[model samples]
Target chain A: MKNPFKFKKEIVNADLFNNDLPLPHSEEYPDEEVIFSVKDFQFYYDNGEKHALKDINLEIFKKKVTAFIGPSGCGKSTLLRCFNRMNDLIDGNKKEGEILYKGTPIDTLNTIQLRSKVGMVFQQPNPFPMSIYNNITYGPKCQGLRNKKSLDKIVYDSLNDVGLYEEVKDQISHSGTSLSGGQQQRLCIARCIAMSPDIILMDEPTSALDPIATLKIEELIRKLKEKYTIIIVTHNMQQAARISDYTAFFML
Target chain B: MEKKNKKINLSYLIERNIKNRKYKDGITNGSTFLFSLLCVVILFLVIGYVLFTGANYLTPGFITSNYSQSSVALRTPKDFVYNENDYDFSDLERFDDTYYSEKWGIGLQYGKDNNQNQVIYLVQMSENSPFHELVRRDDGTNFNIPSDMYLSYITVQTELGTYKTAFSEDGIENMISTLDEAVSIYDSNFLTLGGGISTSLITTCYLILFTLIFSLPLGIGGAIYLGYYAKDNRITRIIRSLVDMSSGIPSIIFGLVGATIFIPFVGSMTGTTGGNIFTGALTMTLILLPTIVKTVEESIKTIPKSMISASLALGASNTETIFKIVLPNSIDGILNAAILGIGRTIGESAALVFALGTFITAAPSFTSGNTTLAVHIWYILAGEYPAYEQACAISIIIFCVVVVLSLSTKLINYLFRRKRER
Candidate 1:
C-alpha cells in the first residue's frame, strides 16, 4: 500500500522563466508622492560586459516603506545599491542609468553628501566596533557637531525613536556589539536616524534574525514609515506583505 | 571451510597486527622527538655563542667610556715631559711606598688627603695611547709602552700603602669618556654623539623629530594608496612588489643611496662639504619608509569594507572617510607601524655610516660630523684598538631603547584589539 502522506517534489522548469516582464511605471500612484525616480536604468558587471539590470523605469514614493521581493540572483540587491551609488565600490561594476533623488540626479550629486541624505542599514547589523554612544553619534560627528549636549540629545532621541532608548539608556556607552540580535538591529536603525537623513535603505535587515526578532523588526518598519522613506529588500514574502505599503515583486 | 579458517586465525592475527602498528608508531614518534630536540639545541647554541663573544669585551671602564680616544699609542723621547694637567687617577689609592719600574713608563705616586685618602698614580696612558700600559717605577719615574709588548710593573710610594696595579690590555679611557658623557646626557639621546651631554640630548630629539617628519605622512600616503585607492591591476602589483623588495633591501644599500642622494642634496643646499642632521634624517627616512608603509597598510586593511561604505554613504568624501572613519579606527595600527619605524631608524648602522659619518666630538654642529648610538658602537668596534667594551655598553643601551618602544607598541595594539572585540 502507498503512503497517503508522501508527495512528489516538483521540479521548476528553467525554460519557463521569463526574460521580460511588465516594467514598473515611472509615475507614482494617485496618493503617492515620488521620492526617487529610476529612468531607463541598466546595470552591468565586468565593466558593462554582463548585464545585471535591464532598462527599468520605477518610482519610489515618500514616507512609505517599499519592499523589493525576489528569488536569489534576481538583481534585487543590486537595484537597491544603485539608489546610494554603493555599487561604485565593486570594481568592474558599471551602470548606465538615471537614479533621481528628490528630482535631483543622484549621479551628479556629491556621492558622500548623497549617502548622508540617503542613509542605509545593511543585512548584517554592522554596528561599528565602538560604544553604542559612538555608533549613534558617528554620523553627526562627521557632520561636525562638537557640543556634548547636542550629541547626547541626538543619541537619546534617535534611540528613543527606534524604541531602544529605555532598554539601553543606562548602558549607552557600552559597545553596540554587546546587544541581542534584535537590539543590535534596532541600535543600527537608531544610528541611521541620528544622521537625520531623508531616506533609509535596508538590505535583508531581518534575514539573519530569528522569528521573534523578525516580527519585532517588521513592526519597527511599519512605525518607521511615518517619519522616513524606507526601502527594504527581503526574501520573506510574508515580511514584505506585513510591513511594506508598496511591494515590487521580482523574479529571475 | 571458510568459518573454520576465520575462527582459528582471529587471535593470532590481532596480536601480530598490534605489534607491527606499535613498531611503526614508535619509529615515527622517536624521529619527530629527535628532530625537535635538535632544532632547539641548535638555536640555544647559536644564542649562547653570540652572547658569550659579545659580552666578553664589557669591562667596568668600557661601560662608562665614550671610546673617542685614538686607538694607537703615540711615543716620544723621555726628554719630553708628560703634562700633569691632563692626568686623572682620582679613583686610585696607594698605602705604601715601594721601588717601581720607571724605565718602561710604569710607576705609582700617591698624594694623601685630609680624610686619610690617598690618590695612586701608576703609569697613565694618554688619550691617543689607550692600549699603552704605563708602569710606574719605585723612584717615581714611569714608562708608557704599547700593551702588545712586554712591560714590567714597578713598586710605587704611597702615603697609605703600595699596591701593584695589573697591566690591562683594554684601555679604560673610552669608558671614562662614556661616563662623563652619560652623566650629562640621556642614554637614548642620539642628538649629541660628540658634543657634551646637553648637545647629545638635543641631537637625539632632533633626529627623532626629523625621522618622524620625513617618514610618517609619506608612509601613510603610500599605504593608503596601495591599501585603498589604487585599483588591483598590473601597476598596483608592480608597486606592491617594489614595496616588498624595498623592505627586504639591505640597510647598507639604503645607506649608499642615502649617502649618494640625500647627503649631496642637503650638502648643496647648505653649502657644506659633508651632510648634516638634515641629510642624515633624509637618509633615515628612506631606510624607515618601507617599515612604516607595510605596517600601516596591514593596519588599514584590517578595517571592514562595510564601515568604509557606511562612512561614504553618510556623505563623507573619500578624503573625509579616510581621515574620519578609516584613520580614527586604525590609529592603533598606525601607532604600531610608527614605533616599528622608529626602532628601525634607531638601530640602523651601516646605512647611516655613509649617510651620517661617525665623527663625534665634544660639541656637535648641524654641519659637523655626528654619530648615532648604533654608529658609535660600529666605530668603537672598528677602531684600530677596537674598544669592544664600549661597544657592548652601547649595544645594551640600544637594546633597552628598542625593547621599550616595541613593548609599548605591542601593548597599545593589544589594548585596541581587546577594545574592538569588546
Candidate 2:
C-alpha cells in the first residue's frame, strides 16, 4: 500500500515564521509538482482606491492540503475567492495578475466551467433550503445529469465521503437546514465534493462548529487530500499546523 | 421641615404625571377601538339588509327564466244568462263554462277586417242583448265576417254573474311553452314582465375568464423583470414610481380610455359596431396590470438574496432561477393578485359599461352587447321605477361570490406556506 500523507514529514519539524519572509531557496523536493501558481497578483477594491492584496506570489502542490493562516483583514479569504473567479461577483473590485491552474491561465477558462472544476465551501453553513438528498444532487442536476440511478450513487458516495451518511441515512429527505451547525457544515462540505471537482476551496469550513466537530473536519481534511487538492483559509493557527501539508501566513 | 415639604411635593407631582399619561392613552385607544367597531357594524348592517330583501326572490325559476312581457286575455262563457235554449252555439259548447251556464248559451265568430286580419267577437242568445266584442279595433270599424275562423274560446257577460278570466304572461302554461319554443328562436324579444339575470351572469363569467387569462402572464412577467432583472437606477426608480401612481387613478378614467381605445380596436377585429365582452376584458387587463405587478414585485423583493445566490452558484440560469425558486416561493402573492383582480372585475361597472355596453341579451355571444352583474344592478337602479328588490338580490349574489373567492385564496396561501415550512 502507498502512504497518503507523504508530505507530512516536510512540515513536521518546520519553524513557524512570525513575519512575511521571502521564499526559501533550498531544494527540498527534486520532483515537486505544482497545481496553482500565483504570479505578481494584486487585488484592489473600491475602484483601486483601496488595496486588498499586494504582489502575492505563491505555489500550491497537487493532491496536498495547503492552508492560508492569517488574522482578520489579511486578504486570505479574498485570495481563496480568486482561485475560481468568485471575486468577479463583487462590484467595482479589480484584479491585475495571472493565476495559473495546472499550467493554464484561470482567466482563459469559462467561469461556470472553472467553478464546476474547483468547488467552494463557505465559512457559514449555507446549505440550500432543501432536503439533504436534493442538496447533494444539486450540482449534478445543474450539469444536466438526468439518470436517477447514477444520481443516487453520487448522493450516497458524497454523503459517505464526509462521514454524514450514518447520522442522516434515514432522514436524507429532511431539510438540510434542519441539521445542527456542525452537521450543516459537514453537509456543505459534502455538497461541495458532490460535483467531483479537482480542487476544493474551503473558507474556514469548521469555524462555526464545536471542538469535536472541528477535530472531525480536520481528520476529514487529512483523508480527503488523497483524492483532491485542498486549499483552506483559517484563522486558527493550531488547526493550520495540525492538518495542512503546507501553511502560508498572510500579514495585514 | 423644608426637606419633608420637598419630598411631599415631588411625590405628588409624580402621581399627577402618571395619571395624566394614563388618561391620554385611554382616550386615544378608546376612540380607535370605537371607530373600528363602528366600521364592522356598518358592514354587517349592509349585508343584513341585502339578504333580507333579496332572499325571497332568489328562486330557481328566477335564475333560469328569461326576460319577457306578453299580453293575452282568455275568458269563459259562464258570465252570460239567456232566455232561449234553442240556439246554434255549437262552437262555444266545448268550453268548460258552457256546461255550467244552463240559462245562457254563447255564440263565437271571427270576422275579416279591411286588412284581411281575423278579429274575434261573441254573440249572445238572450233577446235584446248587444253583441260582445272580445278583440276589437278602437275605431269600432266592423268589417266583413269569416265563418271558418278558428274558435279557441268564448267570453260572455251577464247581469248578476261573475266572469271567469285569465290575464297573464308568465302563467304556468305560458312559461313551459315559451321555454320550449325558445330553443328554436335565436333573436326573440323578451315579452314577459318577470325577468332574470342569466345573461348578465354568463357575460360576467366570460369577462372574468378572459381578463384573467390576458392579465396574469403579462403582469407576472413585468413583475419579474422589475423585481429581479432591472438595475437599481434612475430609470427603474421612475418606472416603479409610475406603476405605483397608476394604481391610484380612478376606474372612471380607465372607462374613458377603454371606450376610446379598446372598443375601436376590438371593433376592427370582431366587426362589432360599439362594445363587447372582448373589449371589456382587454380594458380590464390594462387596469389590472399595475396592481398585480406592484404586489408581485414587492413580494419577490421580500425573498432573501441568499436564496438567489445559492441558485446562481449552482450554475442555474436566471430564467430557471426565477421559474423554480422565486415564483414558487411567492405563490401567495400570485394568488393575492388573482383575488384582487377578480374582485375588481366583479365590482367594475363604469369601465365595463363603456367597453361592454349595458344592453342585456338573453343569449349573449362574445361579440354581442351585454351587461355584467354590476351593470345590471346599475340599470335596475337607473330606471324610472328603481327595481330595488332585484338589485338587492344581484348584490347578494355578488357579495357571496366575492367572499367565497377571497376565502379560497386565503386557504390556498395557507396551504402553500405550510408546505414550504415542511
True-structure RMSD, every candidate: 13.7, 13.1
lDDT of 2 by residue, A1-252 (tens): 223246322111111111122323323443556767898999998778889999999988777899999889989999998997878666567889899776667776666666777778888887777799988888788878899999999999999999999999999999998898889888988888888877898989888889999998998898899988899999898998898989988999
The candidate maximizing DockQ is 1
Q: How many clashes in candidate 2?
A: 5
User: How would the docking of model 2 be graded?
Assistant: incorrect
Cα-based lDDT for every prediction: 0.69, 0.73
Residues B1-422, candidate 1, lDDT per residue (tens digit)? Answer: 45554356778888989989999999999999999999999977855554565454433333333323322222232233334354454433333452232222223344221112232333343343322323222232334443222222212222233322322222233223222222111111001012112233345556777888988999999989988888777778999999989888888888888788887788778887675678778888887787888888888999998888776776667887788777888788789877887787678778878887777654457886677777776766686887554455456556667879989987997899888877
lDDT tens readout by residue for model 1, A37-62 = 88899999987788888887878977
